[model samples]
Each structure stands twice: as structure tokens, then as C-alpha cells.
Target: MDDVHAVRKPRDSWWTVFLVDPVACRLTLLVADRTAITPNGLTGVSMALGVTAAISFALGQLAAGAALFYLSFMVDCTDGKIARLKGTGTPFGLWVDYMGDRIRVICCAAGLASGQYAVTGDVAYILLGAGVTVLDLFRYVNAPQMKRVREVVRENRAQREPAGEHLARQDPAGENRVPCDPGPAEVAAVLNEAAALIREASAQPHPGAHRVLRLYRRIGRFLGRHRVRPHLMSGIEFHAAVFVAAPLLGSWALLPVSTGAGALLLLNEIFLIYVLWLSTRTAPASPIPQRLPV
Candidate 1:
């Protein structure tokens, strides 16, 4: 038996790619439990491939780097699928998953740092982005401390507002989303609805059926109205995607692709100040609980 505790069914059906979303992974695993590969083993394998890819990219071997990159993603996808299948993917495994993510992020730095300082012998533009990346990394690392500070401020400063206050606070453009802390009863209702949709989607041949599309549209409008987008404007997804694309594009042979990809990455990062500013905003309060400052 795996030493880790199985994660309670989490609510993450939309994140099949990372396969890190426990609840959706759980459902997927139980429903397809024949091939029995251990999740941790797969995690190790994926990490190895990720490190290999980073090394390849660092060495300026773009073709091999690209292939290994995809291979690492496959390992990532497969591990979660295996975990869900084996019922062994615990929160500990989830922690390991994030560690794997960190490894790749470092790999990204290694690749780019090599490109700038070693390969091209130019440290101007690359150094600038690297500093930004480090600051972004700090934002993530200090997220817990930042979250506590904010909650303290919120509890002390935010008076319980009447429902009317929600009107201006909810901006659909994903600007300044008002806090919507629905209590337990309301949270239960939302969970029930989400579970129902999942069941319905599973039964249908097209998961993105008419009903699902309608739900997606409604959600989009709701997010637009309240400006309640995922707290991931410059999220890990955008970070890693851009990191890999940069070297591949900018290779002496692929200059145009390099310039275009770099521009897109810069644009996305510049526009998404929300992510960097709020990585520590309102993360799920840790179960063990942190000491609040007096």
C-alpha cells in the first residue's frame, strides 16, 4: 500500500492535461482500473524526462529538446492517469507533483540562462526576463505569508457588506472581482451541481454536449460579469509554454518563430499583473493552520 493518504475527491474535471486535479483523476482512475502502474514510479519517470529535456534544451539541441519536452508532458499525463487508476494518488503525491513542476521551471531557467550567458554571449534581454522570472518565483514562494497578511487585512478591514455591495465589486472583465464567500450550505449546492454535470458529461458521447456548452457559456458570462477569472493570469501554464517556445523559436535557424513567440509571451506577462500580485491572495487556508500576526 502506498504510504500516502488518498486525496478526498477534489473538484477539477477541466484539468485533465496536468492530471494533477485529484477528483477528476480519481473518477478517471476508478472507471479504468485495469493497467496497474504505480503513480509515484511514473512521477519519477516523468521528472527524469523533464530534467533530460531541460538538459537537452540547455545544450542547444532544439530538436531533441522538443521531443523530450513532449515526452515529459506524456509522462506527466500518464502518471496522473495511472494514479487515478491505482487509487494511490494522495495529497503527498500532489506535493510531489508540484515539486516536479518546480523542477521544470528551474529547467526553464537553466535553458534560457545557458542561451543568454553561454550560447549567445549576450546577457541583456535574457537577464531582464530572468530577473522577472525570479521575482515571479518569489511571488509563488511567499504566497503563504502573503495570503495570511491579506486575510488579516480583509477580516479587520472588510466590514460585512449587504448584498447590494456585490454590485460594483463584481466586474465581468476580470478586473477587481469582489469576494464571494458563500457559506457551507451554498458551497454544498455548488458542489452538488458540479458533480451532477460531471455525471451527465460522463454518460454522454460528447462531454462537451449542448448542456455542457450552455454551462460553459454561462460560466464565461458569469466570470465576465464578476471579473472572477481563475487566479492564474500568468499561471504556470503560460509560464512553461512560453519558456519552451522561446528557445525553439529564437534558435539561429528559427528567428521569426523566435521573435513572434517571444513577443506573445511578453504581451501575456505584461498584461497579467493580477497573477503576480495575488499568488498569495486567498489560497485554501492550510489544514494545519498558520499563526496570525498580532
Candidate 2:
């Protein structure tokens, strides 16, 4: 039980936290206790399941495909947990996991589009599949670049600010902190302040911005209590909604559900960009200090 708790990520997407982790964590424990499975081995299993799911989709077995995809995802989640628990994580394993995810998405999209078009004789399913693949690609590619930009911004800010001031800014309460683990309260406070700053920096603040921020804060606080992020429509949730929920709701719901999920994912990405821009805009412009002539 303690191992399960320890293996869980401190923060994760809401979909993983609510729907996947409970099962994944237990399965992770079982694999650790009962098997000689390496993380790479688990990755292989996940890839196999994902491919099977794609094949099922190609046959128009929507329900079966959904179930298998969900199971694949569950096993996918477990591989990481087991790796963390056993300290057997490897760079090769990470590469395999990342590539496996991309392959699964592409395969599933092609299979789904082909099957649906075969049934309905509509070209839109083909377009939808292509669009989904592009969207997923965009999200994955943009995420790392965004992260790199944020890191650069933070480094530049730290260099510009005096060391004492930077330290003070990081720990206003003057408590010693772990390097990467800012607790939920701190995260919520930072986000709330960012939203307020963004609102104030706007030429004409939206009237509903405050209310929206407040609701966001409330939701963030609620999810933070469970170690889940407030962004409910992240890529993980988007995938689950498109593949699993849409299938369960019947073939007719697939288009609308995918569209809605894609829109929400875009909105979340836009909001993040807005926040980053506002942070840069509102940041203090301090000059680098020069050495006086000796």
C-alpha cells in the first residue's frame, strides 16, 4: 500500500488520477511482486495491446476496441509506476514508451477512419482521422518547445534578479524548499496570481474574467487536494474522450465528442500561452549589473 502510494506521481492529469491510477498502481505492485518483468517488457506488452486495439477498430469493433485501448492505457500507466518503484527505469525504455504512444495514435486513427468510411461511405471520417493525428502531433511537439521556452525564461529572470531577491521571490514564507516539489498550495497561489496579473495587464479586462478565474481557482483547489491538475482536457483526457467515451456513446457521438475534446485541448493550450505571455509582460525589467572600473 505504501509502495503504491509512493509510486503514484505527485501530480497527474485528472483522467489518469481518477480512472487509471487506481488500477495501474495495483497492477504495478502485482507485476513487481510476481514477475521478472522489466519496464521494457511492460512497454512491449502495452504496445501489443495498443496494436490489437487498432486492429479491432479496423474491424469496426468499436466497443471491443475501446475496451482494449483502455486496458492498453492502464498497462501503459503501470510500466512507469513499476519502473519508479523498482528503480529500473531506462532511457531506452523512455524512448520506446514515447514512440509507442505515437505509433498507437497513428495506427488507431488510420484504423478508425478506414473502418468508419467503409461503413458510412463518407470522406469526413478520413478527414477527421487526419485532423486528429495532426492535432496530437502538434500537442506533443509543442509541449517540449513550450517547456524549453519556460525554462529559458526562468533562467533569464533568475540571472537578471539579484540572488537574494530571487530566493525571496521563490520562498516568500522563508521556508527551505525541495528543488522541484512545490506543494499544491504554492502552485494554486502562483496560478491565481498569474491569472489576476493577466487580467490586469489586458487593455480591457473581460468582465467575466474574475468570475472565471475564481471558478478556476476553486476547481484547481479541489483537484489539487487529490494531486490532480486542473486542466481536465489535456492530451490524456482528450485521447480517452475521443477513443473510449465516443465509442461507448455509440458511433454517432464520435465526431462531436472528438471535436469538443479537441476544442477544449486548444483552449487549455491557449490559456497557457496567454499566462506565459502575461508573465513576461508584467515581469520587472532589471538591467544586468556591470563591474566598476578598477
Per-prediction TM-score to the true structure, in the order listed: 0.52, 0.83
| Tens digits of per-residue lDDT for model 1, 19-101 | 33333344335434555456776778778987887677677676666667655655665566566545677989887876886
lDDT of 2 by residue, 43-162 (tens): 888888889988988899999989989998899888888888989999888899888888888888888888899999989889879988988888787665555444544555667766
Cα displacement (Å) at residue 123, model 1: 1.9
> Distance (Å) between predicted and true CA of 152, model 2?
2.2
lDDT of 1: 0.47
Runs with alpha carbons beyond 4 Å of true place in candidate 1: 1-34, 125-129, 132-136, 142-233, 252-294
**TM-score attained by model 1:** 0.52
Among all windows of ten consecutive residues in candidate 1, which has the lowest summed lDDT? 179-188
Q: State the lDDT at 195 in candidate 1.
A: 27
